[model samples]
Target: MTLKVTDLCIARGGIPVLTGVNFTLAPGAALILRGPNGSGKTTLLRTLAGLQPPLGGRIEAPPESLVYAGHADGIKQVLSVAENLTFWARVFGRRDIDAALAAFELAPLADRAAGTLSAGQKRRLGLARLLVTGRPVWLLDEPTVSLDAHATALFAAAVRAHLAEGGSALIATHIDLGLAEAAALDVAPLRARAPAPDDFDGVFA
Candidate 1:
């Protein structure tokens, strides 16, 4: 199914941050979000992932079609690497996690506790959860944070494989994940204008 967003508007803390956003993500494709820091990329992804309600506009997709991977890693530190994937897989009604483990080269550390992994390893484990989700649309926020070059390539390959299998991804990141087939969307132009300075703006200060 294609993921569609029409005239979308997003907000942070009840204040508009991105407006007039529009895009379509067809199956087997990836859309990379481009923007400088504080340009509402994270907020937009959060809204799209249903972490928060949209301020306006429409998102057209099947229910439970989207899966999100954010900066928090979302893994239980006490669980082993394999266990973490298994736990998420079960939540998504999946039981097979071998492919996910190998996708991130996490098999060797499968038995190690998530808390024992390094920063890069943890990030990879966090990302691997996407596979277990079995969701068609992926909303990723800064997916490569703390990843080294090899790990990034692993992630890029995993994304390519996902696209090949008719899955779509919306990623917010500044780095190239080596996905030449992925299209880019710059959110800077869609950024909501700064609110006009008001005399009472600093009243609370």
Candidate 2:
């Protein structure tokens, strides 16, 4: 599957944060979204994930064909790592959670509550949940935020494998993710343009 964004403009609280953004992600490819704070990296990712609606552009993709892993881990504080995966698996109508947990080296911590896990560990768990979905497109916002070298390597490997399998990804991160063919898109220029007085209301509303 492919992700196509046409003249996408994203807004927050009725103010334009990203404007006139355009890009396409073909299958087996990746895009690295970069920009300073308030430059709309996260906003762009959110828009692509369908978590945030576009103000005046269009995002064309199947509803259930994409997975979004945002800055928040999206974990349940009261649930164990395995429990969290179990819940999500059921939500997505899946049965097997072991393989995904194993892939992320989270099997040993399966029984531990997410609240007890370290930051990096929690991030890994969040990522593992995304893997379980087996979705064709991934919108990851700072996916490697708290991961260490080893975990980062694992995440990169997982991404490589995902692309090898003909999946597409749009990653918003400041760090290089070791994606060999991933194209980088800088959003600063778009954000630099002055916002119209009604830009926010027009775009985000």
Candidate 3:
């Protein structure tokens, strides 16, 4: 599937943050969104995921085919690793959990309670949920947070495998994920500019 955004505008708390943004992501490709803090990368991803409406323009993609993973891991503290994946698999109407568990090397920790895992372990489990989601387009925000070098490489490999299987991803992160041929989008240029002092004078009228 192709995900296309044209002249997109995004806002946070009703305040415009980004405007005139545009991009197209084809199957087997990825787009990395780079920007400084508070630059609206997360807001853009959230809009694409349909968590919030775009302020303007259009996004052409099937809503049901997209899965979003935010900075939060979204794992149940009381659930076992395998059980957590099983629950998501059921939600997505997929019956298999082995692939996802093995993909993130979580098979060994399958029976471990989510609460007992370290920060990195929990992040891995959070990422593993993507596989079980059965959705093609992944919208991830800072997916590498708290991950060490080795774990980051593992996550990169999993993403590469997904793209090889014709899946696409839109990632918002500050560091390199080692995804070959992935396009980089610097959101700085797309950020909304505050109105000039003279322009704002009209608001007070």
Residue-level lDDT of model 2, residues 1-205, one tens digit each, is 9888888888776677777888999999999988887788887887777776777788888978899998889999999999999999888888799877877899999999999999999999999987778798999988999999999998998899889999999998888887879999999988835556767644335
lDDT per residue for candidate 1 within 83-192, as digits (tens), equals 99999999999999999999999999999999999999999999999999999899999999999999999999999999999999999999988899989999999987
Reference-based TM-score, model 2: 0.92
Q: Best by lDDT, which number?
A: 1
| lDDT score, candidate 1, position 83 | 96
Candidate-wise lDDT, in order: 0.92, 0.87, 0.92
Model 2 lDDT, full chain set:
0.87
Question: How many clashes (backbone atoms < 3 Å, residues ≥3 apart in a chain or on different chains) does model 1 have?
Answer: 0
lDDT of 2 at 96: 90
lDDT of 3 at 134: 82
Worst 10 residues of 3 by lDDT: 196-205
Please give the range of 10 consecutive residues that has the lowest summed lDDT in model 2: 196-205
C-alpha RMSD values across all candidates = 2.7, 2.1, 2.4
Task: In candidate 3, list every pair of residues with a backbone clash.
Answer: none
Ranking by TM-score, best first? 1, 3, 2
Question: Which regions in candidate 2 have their CA more than 4 angstroms from the true location?
Answer: 196-205
Q: Which of 2 and 3 is ahead in lDDT?
A: 3
lDDT of 3 at 171: 96
